[model samples]
Target: MKNIQRLEMETKGIALSQQELIIYLQENGLQPHEEYNAQSPSAKKAIYQTALSTLESVANNPEMMRNVKMDDMTVSEFHENLTDRIDQLEKKIRGMRTDANQSDFFMLFN
Candidate 1:
């Protein structure tokens, strides 16, 4: 949740409270008592990957791309924004994997 919120805020300037996050997550079957451990790299990666997949779906939708108006955003502008965001998320996920693997590879060299 922290990872998702941080990236969203940094990339899109959108801020969400914990309460709001929990409410929507509940709709997806997430329990309130459930929490993610900061030490779990796989858990964080899975969440990021899921977010990336969802954003990609909307960004790649041809039918939904025509004449769309989201607040003050036009279709082209929205597409452009999504494209930038997708690039950033992909880079972040790749960096996470690379960093993790590099540390593990250090033991092999030793």
Candidate 2:
């Protein structure tokens, strides 16, 4: 299964935000599902199921609750984190565009 598709399915099941899903995929070294071909349907299904199960388990985990104390975060801290995340996302988008342009250039030149 492609990593992105698996992550998408898992994120849907767990109700995770895009940022959280991206972070989880990166942490697990999983690529987006589109990176995989359709020849291995069974493998893709298995990966999707596994990821969904794991996400559900983690969403219900008490340990995760203990680690992120919402009450402890100040408004300013939350705002700062949101701004930082937005900046990071903007950077990633720019990088993706650059990569796409490079690939296009190579295809044309090579």
Candidate 3:
């Protein structure tokens, strides 16, 4: 019973990590290319396997594990930090778009 409970908890953590990765990719417009998506099941599996291997390698690295342990922040604090970074990036992008439009308008008048 204890083993089952531990396995269930680990499975939940992996699912959450995968979901977060998917969300991050989508937010960054990093969807799989159309050709890859249209490929057969084997091809898709290969892609996913590569991603999983990469993640596992990083997670198992001593330096990376050390960094994770050194972070004293709570989960909520981590989320808040990421939120602020996203907000700043969005604002910067918006400002760039506005500046580009203004430049185009001035060029048209000139």
Give the candidate number with the greatest TM-score. Answer: 1
Reference-based lDDT, residue 36, model 3:
41
Off by over 4 Å in 2: 38-110
What are the per-residue Cα lDDT tens digits for candidate 3 across 1-110? 22222222322323335544444334433343323432344333333333443345444454543444325775455445444544554454444422124443445464
lDDT of 1 by residue, 1-110 (tens): 45445334333433345564455444433343556445666555555665565566567675766645578888789789888888988998876742246464445464
Judge candidate 1 against the unseen true structure and give its global Cα lDDT, from 0 to 1. Answer: 0.58
Ranking by lDDT: 1, 2, 3
Winner on TM-score between 2 and 3 is 2
On a 0 to 1 TM-score scale, where does candidate 1 land against the true structure?
Answer: 0.56
TM-scores across all candidates? 0.56, 0.32, 0.30
RMSD of 2: 11.5
What lDDT does the true structure give each of the candidates?
0.58, 0.48, 0.39
* lDDT of candidate model 2 versus the reference: 0.48
List candidate 1 stretches off by more than 4 Å: 1-34, 66-68, 97-110
**RMSD list, candidates in order:** 6.3, 11.5, 15.0
